[model samples]
Target: MNNTALLKPETARDEVYAAPLKDLNPAQPALFQANTMFSIFERLRAEDPVHYTPESDFGAFWSVTKYKDIMAVDTNHEVFSSEGGITIGDQPMEEGPLPMFIAMDPPKHDIQRKTVTPAVSPMNLARLEPLIRERAGKILDGLPIGEEFDWVDKVSMELTAMTLATLFGIPQEDRRKLTYWSDVVTAAPGQGLIDTLDQKFEIFVEYHAYFTELWNQRVNADPQPDLISMLAHGEATRNMEPREYFGNVVLLTVGGNDTTRNTISGSVLALNQNPDQYKKLRENPDLIPSMVSETIRWQTPLAHMRRRALQDIELGGKQIKKGDKVVMWYVSGNRDDEVIENPNDYIIDRPRVRNHLSFGFGIHRCVGNRLAELQLKVIWEEILKRFPTVEVAGEPKRSYSTFVRGYERLPVIIPSRL
Candidate 1:
């Protein structure tokens, strides 16, 4: 079999999509940094949905690339545990693991997650809707017409950061710090965010100190609806270890901030790139909900979640041994052609729009998903009401980590209203 000849043309045509299995290592952060991950994911889904990489920077691991296989691993928490950590790289052993509920299994995960669930519940969303709309209106109306700006900074970050502050009942002035900490938590060295472990630790130390002050303030006061108060007063979470407290804070902050902000940025990029679909959206603003769902599917904000195998399991004809690290590549699964028709196209009005892997399928699914959707829907609705179009000024600057499929800057200019 002349593997090179067959693979070479496809590799040249779509460089990321046709690499030979021997040369394929999906865990390499460089693939993500280069934004060529779809090619690797496409090749894997077609050839080997459950493939093993013998060696890589993050050590040996299995990559689960198809839609159903990812769902199986994600839902069967009993077989594939999250206790090892959620990202491909294990948490720094020298410092020890941070005890966030997202990385815990069974009873502990259930109880702790329940504490913060109310903050994003249907009733709470109703409380936050008017506030979100007001903020979205202000942010969009404030953008300089016909002048270019980083949409990520002016709109995406500001909105999500403000909402995060509201959820925590923190001062509006300090909201940007939550965005900073979330970026630092996912960033690796040379990603141009944090350059060294010492630097990372310093930022986290400050984060711990700041949030500890808030926790202290909340614990002594009468109960409130904010997340800090929920944790301070909840039966499962009160009296938490300092690291555990820090871990949960990171979880909520990153979960709330990154997913929404990135999607907001990504939706603009997706819509602009697909002008026909953008035209559809403009012609019918009622497609906002479907567009919101499609943007999440297309962006897949958090690329993959790592789970450690609790017992040997057979999946997609591959044997995964106990303790082996298995990554459910949601970004890949969301693009699987077997499940999603026209998987690569950013069609806003796709039928069964919600049937995608942006949010995991089981108990560990993103709890704040509805809130993220609400923020996006409100912002887009506001944008359409004002500007005829939001033009992309130039190429987007994407985030550097494999785990966070997001943009760092999206330059755009909104022409004066018609």
Candidate 2:
């Protein structure tokens, strides 16, 4: 529990079992920041699949860690509503609750989601693929080979920021602003991005102003292929309230941002940790698609999705009351042994690699799920063509949040590019 001496996975394994299941608080951002929460999740999955804590940093919430149980809660949108919010600790916006589709229920969720769906549609992503590959190649090629560099910042953040900007039809030059705003939205106090809630709200004010200007510009011009134009002209979303529009834009921005960025970082670390998988991938570059899916499952980038129970329901022999916070730990569920064979092992050729819960299930499943995979696929393909291996030069600094399970900095070296 000492912050001075960070918890190693081995130590975390023993530490988690030492505490009583009821006393364990799975929502601690420190546990995630240290990357030692998996042992805690493993213990919970075996002992208490539907575990609850009376009090914690994010207030009392339920942890649904099993694959089947998570699927139940995720799929039954009617029973477990996202209306409360997606993250366990839902921070209220200064402007009040942003009415985004990912957090809305029923007919309303469908309407708002439909409006922006085209921005990331298959047709749209197909058009974007060449650009993603070009950007990925450029990003990778620009890396200082044989020298240690932060992959999360250099490759992950930069590439995702560009893609996010392209998706929104914003200037690629201003992409880092998108990256900064996305990080601020999810960062908590002392996380290194921003310190206080007030700072976060202030950043959003600027973010809202910029996006609102884009909306105004697009609303007047003929409809364009960009997301802002889509929202500016969509039948249901055109007359949206300011907060409502901001909510949807944030949803798309962060949704497009986090999942791909983190997973890209994770894939490198995973391949290094599992050298056999790396060998397999190197020998058969055709496995890049499978590797991407496996990495998504292995990383489970967005750790958990939270929902407020709409009605009382029995799950895993425990009663979940209406209004209770229910969290589907996708990170844990992906490692559940019941559904996945050798769940903890990172196998690039694992069968049904896409069967994992990283991208929630049912109505609220990640809208940009395919786009995320496509980005990873293209990036990895470019990586394979260039580097023999991206060696992890040092330990990674994991993201400091329970919600955004990703790396902040990953020191890696591309010894020599081919």
Candidate 3:
């Protein structure tokens, strides 16, 4: 029996509300609507690779969904400038250019990135690996085997927070404050944090005041080998004003918190979803590095990066005027069929995993990509060695913000010991 034929006239109308695929036009609200965004991307990747989406809430923007198109925009920083800011929706806060490095176009972006890049270099990350592993083991050791726990809070957030604390040399007691400031700064209106622009700006002011004290202390004290000290003493960074200092602090806070948190939470979710993949890694411990890359690709935590058109440019036969906001959907790009073979499938040893844009591309590519990778690798390596099996105990809940796609809560149960 055909279900469509069996449905009554009224039921058919109800079906219209349920089926997003029924609305195919790019201009339709369904394109930018949260419920339909992913589905729309899947459809565009199959049909129209570049689509224009206009929304009352977020304003009009070109959604670059395909792999090649996203790569073109992300790598060509000259044509597409990040200085316009990266949020897709209207920012409630009214302030001057917030002075974050991610919001600058080169050669300024280059200079700022170079100042902090050395601190997260492979050699530096290598020195931190053992410490990261020790922290991971300590966190996992505290959990009772075969008992359900919120993995997002207990494992993912804790690990990333501790790692960031180590990176910045923040006191352990103050680490949770880092996570709070990060949430407040990046939280959107719908996320249940501060709703208005004034509140968000006020939060920023408070954060700046706190960091000012920290900065003063760091400035007068003997120099140490941490991100804060490096930024304080680095040739390009020493001259930064209070606003600029706060901006960099906010950048590192969000970067170290959200990306690695999602990676850790997403990896556990991925493993639980694909037990075969989990079993594969458990059997072959050397696969941790590949697994790390695959996790970043599968998660694509930084869902999209926004850019402003510097000048008139034609992409995919569409002419974009200067100052037009263009959003590169890295989440969709990672799953593009042309870039990764069997893009949607989770293959731990997939050879092209590192080619993913989850960390992004070109000049603004993640400044701490190596550190993020090191943290994930160390966590997984230590986890596999300590526990024979770790499984999801309940459905994972996602963060509300589209900008930072991650698990807010993940429940899991692990074996007592190996």
State which candidate has the highest lDDT: 1
Which 10-residue window of candidate 2 scores lowest in summed lDDT?
1-10
Give the alpha carbon lDDT tens digit for every residue of 249-316 in model 3.
Answer: 88889998999998999999898889999989988999999999999998888888899999999998
lDDT of 1 by residue, 10-125 (tens): 34337544446756777766556557667677778888889888787788889999999999999998999989489999766356878899999988999999999999999999
**Candidate 1 ranges beyond 4 A from true positions:** 1-19
Write model 2 residue lDDT over 294-356, tens digit each, in one string. 999999889999999888899999999989999999999999898999998999998888899
State, as a TM-score between 0 and 1, how close model 2 is to the true structure.
0.97
TM-score of 3: 0.90
Q: Relative to the true structure, how large is the alpha-carbon lDDT of every model?
A: 0.89, 0.88, 0.79
Clashing pairs in 1: 16-39
Name the lDDT of candidate 3: 0.79
How do the predictions measure up, each by TM-score? 0.96, 0.97, 0.90
Where model 3 places Cα greater than 4 Å from the true spot, the runs are: 1-36, 195-198
Best-matching candidate per TM-score:
2
